[model samples]
Target chain A: MTGRVIVITSGKGGVGKTTTSANIGTALAKAGYKVVLIDTDLGLRNLDLLLGLENRIVYTIVDVIEERCKLKQALVKDKKNPNLSLLAAAQTRDKTAVNAEQLKSICDTLKEENDFVLVDCPAGIEQGFQNAVAGASEAIVVTTPEMSAIRDADRIIGLLEAKEEITSYKLLLNRVRPSLIKSNEMMSVDDVVEILSCPLVGIIPEDTGIITSTNKGEPIVNDEAALAGKAYRNVAQRILGEEVPFLDLDEPKGFMAKIKNAFAKLKAKV
Target chain B: MEKGFVENGFIIDLSDAKNTTQLVFELSSVMEHPEVKRKNVCLKLGALDLKQSQLLSIKALIESMDANLAFIDTDSEQTEASAVSLGIIVSEISDNLEPSIVCSAAEEVKDEEVVIKTECEVVEEDKTVEVHADLNSNANPIETAEGIEDIYDEQSTQELSEIIPAEHFEANFEALAESEGLIKAEEASKYILLDTGDVLPEGAEENDTNTETLPTLYINQTLRSGQTVSYEGNILIIGDAHPGSEIVAGGDITVWGILGGIAHAGSLGNVTSKVRALKLNAIQLRIAGLYARRNDTLNVPYVQKTNEFTPEEAQIEDGKIVIYKKLRRD
Candidate 1:
């Protein structure tokens, strides 16, 4: 079966595109599909570090396109999943070294073997971003609910639609606060999707553990307790043709119950 | 490559094809290969500006070869031009593939169109799901995993373990911000705003033992509800502070957008601090040791009764923080 290539991108930095790519790749591979996540950030390559595969990236995407190594040679298998691999971006090379055509060729080569190929696009609408999107069959635009990020996402959506890539585009809202939404403090997922006019693929709540995990070069999906982790996993499932409902981040928590649970956990640890 | 031969018919001639063996192999391969099917497979000979004619020929070749003939090329001008002609429009090819896949992938209990019909149903189901979330006010996020697992019961837990189970979080008090909400502290102001400047409080020292050095927090996004920002220094919110979000700074707080959230400036006991926003409708306002809340009573015209409107009038005169509709007219 031919594999699908999905590019995870966000025009703004720190909006969680790399995180989505890593988690979705892992989630898909865990679901039994052979998956390869490519970091196309080049100079700011972080997918390898995010997946903790930096040490295993024998060759980088740059090396493969430059003919220094084969595509398979550059694929670093996730120590956790033999089926999950990472094609790390070169640390020193700039996005100029490659073009969209080169990326398309690279993705084509991977499609012949893997079930899913996810490209972690660089932040910005520059050449690097172009090269990253050039090869992918579909796109996952990641953004936060903040108006600034949402506005950027809207710009991206407009570009993709203008380019006629809208049909294949999906949205992943990160760092969302449902409680804020209920209280009319933050934008609701519905409001975001309505504004972007795109299909909602995932909703990732802001989790501090994500920061800790990033510091450790581990994706939050590795932590089952993190809501963002499940959200990403659900995103992967959706990509695999499964229908999953979005979770409500704005639901009011039973304050007293939460306090009780907080005490329970404290008591348990003791 | 495709030029008209018999008035209405087209022909492609490969007279000078004898130049390269690789070209010969490629020509024969396109003609004879079963999977590499094509119509009017022909070559041409001439001063052929390989850039112009070869590019056209490759386009004709791909069009004739297969609807989805994925192209591969090196940096040669002709090849580059050929690739460009196809426009290598990434999304188009992918979208053309989805319908067929969606059709086959769709589990039809009835007819093939059942899939399309189900698509609508699925959306409706999504709406209901959201409605359900609304009804289940205190739905523990962890329970979602149990529901998901139950949906796919055949799969074992070993199959889908995550590194951080946010759905099944064991909340920590210090980490309460992460769970309850993230409070990014705003920046404090350099100079404090004093309502009663007559006499300093008994322990009113800007640099007192109780005072903590405040850090500058430059918040870039609208602080939405459930998001609280607390800092030891001044807070500068570049975006709107949503009604539900609160910013507590040890110094001063300034918002670029409408500030509807709670703002506490000089929480570290800096009595002279102030809070400012483009539009302020904070649920609770605190500065230094003073705190105030909007009064629901006394039909004080929502609109300004008179000209004066300052933080001083908004402060507590007697024991309670004062909420003056219009600066007490004389």
Candidate 2:
């Protein structure tokens, strides 16, 4: 069966594009769908490490595109999930090694065997970005609350619209701090949505577990206890055409908890 | 039988034709002529008596031959309406032509000349009415063309006002300066012959006649960081200017929303120019050659005592940029 190819891109670097790709791909595979993640960052490849499959990669996307090996020979299966696999990038080669047409052909063959192909696009509007976006039919732009990242995300959205192949696109805001937003020190979700003028698919709050998961070479979505893991699952469900409620940023309070909060406020006043 | 011939181009008179079928057959034969092929010709249809569908079919036939068609000397509104729908130009012969012979022959070339002249006049009137409607819909009162023309007329005798020079002032002045001089010469003669209104008294500054007019650019959206807008004239922004974004203007600058960026007004050294914003939390402000940074110590105590956010204005005073609370004028 043909799969849906979705590219995850952010025009600015260090905005969690690779993190979102790894988590979404893992979460989709956990739901019993065959999924493949391709790291298109070329020289700075990291999707293999994120999936804990770095040592298993014998060949890469560059090898498949160059015809050095068959497409199936380069796809390294994930250690955790049998349905999940990864096509790593060539760390020795640069972005120009694989052209857009070559990537398109490679994705076509991958689509035939998998239920979803998540492309982890490199940051910056360069050849790497063009090659990653050329193969995808849908896009997810990852951004933060900062003005610099949001501006670059806007520029990326414009470039995506110019591509005739991409039919649908959505935004995913990452690294958001709820306390900073409540204190008016940082921009809120509504502020970003208004400026970007795109529908938001997910909001991942700033969590320390993401760092821990990254160090362990595993996506946060596998932890099952982390808030960020739950958020990634919700995003995966949304992509599957399921209506899921967003994760509440504020702590959930019950009836007795509300009474305790009121008494605590009154005691502080005295 | 088609009663018309090809003089300058093909002319078909449909008055003598019996029915729509006969008209279509004859027009098809005219279009197939070897002389009409590969030439840009105006095929004139004179005084047709066919229905709208019949006219449409003839129009389609002419278009297939790649010839431009002009419907002339038609008395029926249905034929004219059909021609218009096909994007064909229509003209009516004047009353000077003989009524019966008007549709019978093509020798009376003088009537076609009169019809062409009247068509041009009708198109000109239609264009002016459309322009007037468009000018009324835009929101800016200053840029609207309503009283500005009257103001230009009333001040014709007075010397042109002095405009503060900026980088674009040279190009703008060269384009407008010569045209205004020519208008003044024409107006002076017309007013002298009419003997209306007093001319300007002597001793007015002759250099003022060449002053340039400054134009203001309006921006309606927020400017994010890494964006910079520089203009040779004034600028008015209706949205917020975020930090890291910068605006440089040759004259005054105004922001209707929050201003958190760097703004430099009167960059060309017009010291009187001012900068105003609804919420001025700018990192840096400059007017003319003087510059000032936001004083955190000065703002903290003021904000605590007032407990209300107030708008601010910045201007050059005593060769330095000073910021103060904006006072309501009205």
Candidate 3:
């Protein structure tokens, strides 16, 4: 069964690209589909650390491209998920170590055995981004609810449009604070979706659990109690062509806000 | 009954050990203490008979912990033969050497000279005590339990140094200063060592060709991330090796500043080659074919600078990269 190649990227750094790749790949694996997560950010790879498989990465993608080891040997199996494995990038090498063709060939070879091959692209649209996007036919552009992140996402989407290999691309709005949006201090989800002019794949709310989970080397998706984890799982469901609705992140918090939210909902109905 | 106090040396009494495994376990557990990082260790092995390989592993285990196995106090004749073959100092603990050892099994393997233990216990210099007794049958046999107590009763610590053979110091490096007092570069990494390019290809045989005879390459500039310097011989850098940089040398690598990158020495498998730095904070320390990544707990994210630098050295011994914190220059 050939897998769909999806590159998870953000033009700006610190936009949760790696986290999105990790959580979505894990969510797919938990759904009983074999998934491969490839980290193409050489010299600054962190996908393995997020999955807690850093120690198990003996050989990296560079080893595969250099032919020092076979591609199968370099695939580090996730500690908890048997169906999910990672192709880690070499932390010591830069983007020039493995070019676009080599990564594309690796992704091509890996797709034959898995249901989804998710490429975690490094920030920027330079050689690293081109190399990451080379392996995949679809893309998920991760953007935070800020002007700078949206601007970068637009640049990434424009780049994706020029490449014929990227048949489709979707946007993932990350770190959306509902209270901030309610107070007009942050951008609303609809505003980002409208500005990017791209279809939405996921909207992950800002959760304190993400920090602890990242440090613990466990993905937030594994924690069922976490709101962000549930949101990521819904994102995975939507990726599987299921019509999962976006999470209602704008829940009222205090008693006064609850009364105001009820009036706003009624006003929307009216 | 581990009563052993020699200056910069520890006398471990493993007489309580029932078997070889337990002895090594207890020895390694005690070696974990900061005090045992670099010191001479004398083992008191009881009646358990150990083969040559087992004895070698025990020696390697001690050496891996940065301690040298100075000698073994054994009761088994087979053990004594194994120790002698391995060039390990085989000493018969005098019945009344230290006021600490209270055992009956020790007096059985007495040698001609009651020299080793007396000197090891009294030497004031750190791990400089070397007592060499010529392998001779215990000429004077005493069947009575208390018969040998009076032979060395009057022998003081100063007079015991007289019997230390002068030739033994250079005879063997079985238990010497080279490996003693080393802090282990603690890493639980896999054994696989990766090569970047044609740089030290895999499955190569180890040749301990002296590194001093090889040519040297010196760089006075700082190495940033992704930059690499590989040399056929020794490589000397006067500046810091940043976190992502790599330094590969056929022989030795000496960095005058912080080494926060990966430093591989004896890259082609010269086990004697070493990696030294003013501050050895390398992400990974590799020697010969061995590699040790810094434990994540000690892995700091950013490069730190300070005026005071406690230089450290890493070298391969007993198939492990043991780091040594060098003495400060006043």
Candidate 4:
């Protein structure tokens, strides 16, 4: 099965790229597609941990590309989803360990077996950025509703266009808060879509579950009850050519939904 | 083609498999349209290939449909071959046949010494008017001809159409009235000069040494940490806008490289001033006194650290500057 190689990138670091990749990969795998999440951050790899497969990573992407191990040997299967896998980056290495061509070949190899290969790109448009994009046939720019993240996302989109890698790019607006958007304290998804000129792929709401999930080395998609988990599943469906509606960030809070949401939140907090 | 005709423009190839057949049809349809086919459309078709006949057919179809078909660049050998086969002259012609004809009127007068290509009346009708300035010198001659027919007075060179038609030219007179283009009128000796080749005056300044005085700020290299450049007029950055770098301009700000810094444009409270960049990602942007941070909330600590290094523009609206993506498509 020819898998679509998608690079999840944000020019600025720590804008939830790994989180987005892990969740989306898990979500897609849960949808029954054979998915592989390749962490291209190299030295600072966190996707394995985010997907709760860190301990299972016996071989890294560096090992696979460097011929120390085969691609299958380097792939760490997610315990939660038998179909999902993680090709962890070498934490001992830096962004320079790999290049775009190597990543492209790696992704090409994986494409023959997997339905989707998600390259979790390192933040910053540097060597690592080039390597991550090298293998990607499509790109998903992950950014928050903040001005800086949007700007960096824009810069990444520009570089992607300049490299002529992908004809069109998609934007994944993560960590958006409905209350903040309603209060005009934060940029709305509309505002971002207007400036970036890219179609909105997914809008992940601000959920503390993502943080807790990260701390626990489990992607939010593993938790079926979490809002973020459901959102990631929606994203996965959208990527699979399903016309799923975006998670309602602007929907007014109903008493029952709010109460259930609050109880869910309180239970998680406790 | 006259000066500025397809200068630095590319050729669009109509034969690409990746492009939708509908798009190719639309382009052909656009060429078939009488108005757009007359305009100088640059082509950059990359590796798309088409047979010579198909290209000629498209070109002729476009030329015949437009009133001003002077943009045809049939000089190249390949195009010349097609033009010969199509029975079309391989010369640059004005899109507006009228101005080209008027311009040619002067050329014919100047070239009186040489054998006239055709009778004056037929030349007038067929755009065969060629003028010669020097009668005695049999040396290289200046040729000016108009391909547009019936758009100008053949007898008197009073262009029936305004040099810049008042209807179409909503002159940026407010800003450029003092420019040489407007002042050239006053510098000329007469309010009206026919195709006699009376030289127009170099109004304002003949040399135009005022380029240095245009209130431009030149940034030598990429903007790095904590550096800021604020100007009342335009700001041109020769390098990248690195993270933590700040640039605030009352007018437009043009960044030549990756703009990964904070840029606040139209800071002088002008809504029209634009902030343009090759790559825009700003950490903090402020247009005028309005301010916006990369991420407004402290929820995501690690993301905030990266946000401080992102670049983008912050424009003022309703007394607040807000960060936005550099490319506003709608």
- Interface RMSD (Å), each candidate? 22.6, 23.3, 4.4, 18.6
Candidate 3: TM-score, chain B only: 0.42
**lDDT by residue for model 3 over B164-255, one digit each (tens)?**
32133222221322433344443343122332222346876789987767777767678987688997778877678987678999888888
Task: Rank all candidate structures by their TM-score, best first, as comma-separated numbers.
Answer: 3, 2, 4, 1
B290, model 3: CA deviation in Å? 3.0
Q: Which 10-residue window in model 3 chain B sums to the lowest lDDT?
A: B139-148
| Model 1 lDDT tens row, A117-206 | 898999889898888887777899999988889888887777666664335998998988766776898988888889888888888898
Q: Score the docking of each candidate (DockQ).
A: 0.01, 0.02, 0.15, 0.03
> How many backbone clashes does every candidate have?
44, 0, 1, 34
Instruction: List candidate 2 stretches off by more than 4 Å.
Output: A252-270, B1-330
Instruction: Provide TM-scores for the models.
Output: 0.43, 0.44, 0.60, 0.43
- By TM-score, the better pick of 2 and 4 is 2
Model 2 complex DockQ against the native: 0.02
Classified by CAPRI criteria, candidate 3 counts as incorrect
Which regions of candidate 1 fall more than 4 Å away from where they truly are? A164-167, A252-255, A258-270, B1-330
Q: Compute the DockQ of candidate 4.
A: 0.03
lDDT tens digits, residue span B1-330, model 4: 111112212122232334335435655654543334445343322233334675565555554655233322432466556546665443333223244444354465543322223333434455332222121133122233223223222423433212222221112222222221221112122111112121111231112121123255656566764467877666777667765456876555667566655566555554544454545444444443333333312112121222122223333334333334322111
lDDT per residue for candidate 2 within B146-166, as digits (tens), equals 122233344344332223333
Ten residues in a row with the worst lDDT in model 4 chain B? B184-193
In angstroms, give how far residue B180 of model 1 lies from its true place.
Answer: 56
Candidate 2, after superposition: displacement of residue A152 in Å? Answer: 0.6
Clashing pairs in 2: none
Model 3: per-residue Cα lDDT at residue A184: 98
Winner on DockQ between 2 and 4 is 4
